[model samples]
Target: VKPTTPRGQLPLLKIDGKQYTQSLAMQRYAAKKAGFYPTDDIDALVCDECCDTLEEFLLKFPFAAKDEEEKKAKRAEFVKGPMTEISKFIEQKIQDAGGKGFVASGPSVADIMLMVNVKSVESGFMDYINTDFYTNYPGITAVTTAMKEHPKVKAYYDSLN
Candidate 1:
């Protein structure tokens, strides 16, 4: 059953009976279908870049440390260093584009990606991490709030709850 996917990943998207691999690729396809993709070429590029950047950062942090002590230290360092830098850059990007709601016009795929990634840090899924993960990044929190208030986005999350 897993042989069809190029990378054998669980998040394979099946649309119209066709299978698609890679979370980012599926996200882009879904965003296009949902009219979340930006109309301008540069805007779309920025959206894609933001999503890819988050994915890369997530990949860099390995939660499976040798022990609890190491785990806590690693997570703390991640939040203080790379994570902070990335969040600041994203915040500035949103600000430079106008602090309405996203890295591009209104709420695009980039906004969704940003919200999801930021929420993961704040959600405390990792026992070692805490709410402090996102307290310093108001811009990211703003995006999360906007996405949460969006009609469809809210509905989807509500269904999960």
Candidate 2:
């Protein structure tokens, strides 16, 4: 998402702009640009659900206990089950939309959204998550593999340190 002049388009001139202040707003614009806007009201509801699910898990990640003995056994359960299930279900929906492996006839914002979402899980979900969850749903995975190879995405990921 571009931070812009007050007109919201330009050779962007705003420094310390609202766009710089709002990560959520930036991501929404990016998702929209990629064509991932929800298709219908129900899908919109689904999108919100998925977003909430991720935030809930993230809320606990920063404080996640460092050792098996350091954290209660149950403290980590909710994050894993719900987060993993939602991702798997969403992956199913992409397939159900069409098995050919795209959310629409061509690439859409949903592909990018899912790619980033799944990558977060790969980094955060400490348990042994087999990428096979994606294999059965190759459409979603294809987008992910391509995104991983993309120059910009690859650069951003490499800069994660």
- Taking all chains together, each candidate's TM-score versus the true structure is 0.88, 0.52
**Per-residue alpha-carbon lDDT of candidate 2 for residues 55-85, written as tens digits (9 for 90 to 100):** 5545644345688654545434544676556
lDDT of 1 at 157: 89
Model 1 scores a TM of 0.88
Check candidate 2 and list the clashing pairs.
Answer: 34-109, 35-109, 36-109, 36-110, 101-139
Overall local distance difference test of candidate 2: 0.55
Instruction: Give lDDT per model, in order.
Output: 0.77, 0.55
Per-residue CA lDDT of model 1 for 1-161, tens digit only, reads 67667577578877788877877777888898898898888888888777777777788776788998999999888877877787788888777777755554668888877777767766777566676666666777778888878887888889998
Candidate 1 wrongly placed segments (more than 4 Å): 4-9
The 10 consecutive residues of candidate 1 with the worst lDDT sum are: 97-106
lDDT of 2 at 77: 59
